[model samples]
Target: MIDNSLGEQYLRIYDELNFDNQASRRVGFCTLENYYATVMEHVGTEVLNTGIDIFGENLAEQWTVTKQILETVDREPPSEFEGILQEVKKHRGNLYHNFREDIPQRRLDAIRDVAEEWRAWLIDCAREYWDTFGAYTLEDFDYIANEINDYSQAYMGDIALKLPTIKRELDYAFRTIAKQRHRRLHYLETPDIFLYDLMPNKTSSEISKISTTYGKIGMMASKIKKGEEIDTDEGEDLMYDARNILISICEQEDPFGRTFNNLHSSE
Candidate 1:
């Protein structure tokens, strides 16, 4: 628990954090989209950038732009700040891609862990800054505000630097998963069979599709190391389809018992 007065102060900081969080999420998604959009924009740009164009004509250009944008934000604490920023960016990417309907509770717990670290760091920074400057008046808040802004900007810049690489990896992973699903559907004895129980309001067919989709993604990932082409438009399309199935599954209850009941009824 946090002290009331401190919590109030923290609330102000929290608001700023929320603002930064939303901004970070937006930046990450924009970066990912830009990466793909750049690739599809023109053949020359695509070839020059090795199929990534979101940052600029190439990775170098993208890095430069990201630096400029991040320079407008604030600074962060010295210890492992970069790692925290990367984790945040990863979560942002996961959310953006709809890879998971809800971040695993464990991941959320990890986020809280980082948030605590950030809070402690910020408090220390504030205390040190105030001690050196001697908070002579209420006007001193402006200085602190500027410090916060600078820290946020710097932290975001660091994250921006890694965005391109992250995007590429995610795209590759998605495509690979898609290809595996495409191949797996052919080998299943009953590819359309339900693998779980649907909730009271859910349909068994939807559950089966979800199960099939999960298996497909697993299959695709296994084959990714075989020097397969997993970054093409076709691959992306397959991933998109698989993701749709997964999302549908998550939206409803499990279909295990319902599937069994139907199977027995058919017999």
Candidate 2:
């Protein structure tokens, strides 16, 4: 699979471009330009490193990775990709150097279309390389597994501690219904648990309170694992005390705007 980072960057570019304001559109264009440069640089660096490793040859410098690869590497990108690269360069240059405050929406849309082509070609090139040569070593798997184990405990522990009673009751109910029907059947709805709600003026139920406390505890544990400092005087009791204070405040039924203004004013 292509790295999630690349997908995330693409999503950011898409989201910013869709904003209703010109400033946001400009920012989207800037982000798209930077990401385009970064991916090209990464592809060039990979080709250069691989060439040095396999063929022990130095490649000449070029304005872009696409050009460098054509000159140095044995492989060639699709003929049409070069044309798309030129289109990408034109947009990148205009966005970078043009002093005009407002870029036409139609021009931005044109660049976006070209950018999609550029990105698709780059991803295909990357995928071809990875398919030709495997992407990782056994050591890499060990490292990834160890990292997952370290963080997963904080999450899985929260679920295990809070959901056993509910899960057991649901299981019993489902089994009873299955026995009546003389066939094994799954629950009608999948179980999903949320840890926190961020909206203002929303009061938490009992389970929500527990989930919030668990979220804090998990956060503290993560910080400790990362060797960051936490409030030591309260020890492990900090989450409980914080939850109680939040509950007390919520019970007051105070106006959210006044409460927010007062809190910030005091700060």
Candidate 3:
């Protein structure tokens, strides 16, 4: 039997490794997952049917989707692989792991614009490669390549694979913080309403950070309460405040605890 201590360490190490892969793996018809699957499949065998099976195998192997794409392709490829890869690198963090920053919908739409084109182009290239060099005819390849753009196993699964877990966690935290902070800022009017969780070992510096963050949250609430015109900067400040407060929970800091030390712990 494996030692429990060693097992714990091993699991921790493994999780960290996957966590660091934040910049690497990606999902979707336009991501490295689909690109590598199409290229390597054509390299090894004729791509038939939706490219889902090949992408699935890549996932099973725990490959970093984008890195695998780079490794499989030459210094250059005919398709816009480089462009797709660049967009992935730029937004993958914000879209997937960046719970700290709420990405603008317009920005996500811009990235999706490129990704959709990449998906369509990738199928085009796959068909050409299969017809010219692979063991498949033009008609056979066309049928398969066409379905690559269809709703297949690989399509959404590829993109979902990169994000779901972190996205879910980040989303929950974001909503909870937004709601609670809003309550403190407007409904309760007192800091104590939503500041129950406290870190016993919180330092003065950390408390200062929380205070500043809390003030920002309150500012957002104030705007809402006043029925004033809240602009983009104010909206972003609310998001930042919510994210910071959620972060304190993870840091085990009793935010504001240091500043109000003399008050009763219950209070």
List runs of model 3 lying over 4 Å from the truth.
Answer: 1-81, 136-267
Local distance difference test scores for all models: 0.37, 0.43, 0.38
Indicate whether candidate 1 or candidate 2 has the larger lDDT: 2
Clashing pairs in 3: 27-158, 27-159, 28-159, 198-254, 199-254
Q: Candidate 3: minimum summed lDDT over ten consecutive residues — where?
A: 253-262
What TM-score would each prediction reach against the true structure?
0.23, 0.35, 0.25
Off by over 4 Å in 2: 1-7, 18-22, 47-63, 70-81, 114-117, 127-267
lDDT of 1 by residue, 1-267 (tens): 111123233233323333234454444344433432332233212111123454344333443343333333343444564454455556555666774333444443344455545444444443333223322222322332333344445432322233233234333432332231222233234434323322224457665655555565555554454545444443444455544543332233111111222333544
By TM-score: ranked, best first: 2, 3, 1
Clashes of 2: 0
Select the stronger candidate by TM-score from 2 and 3.
Answer: 2
- lDDT of the structure predicted as candidate 3: 0.38
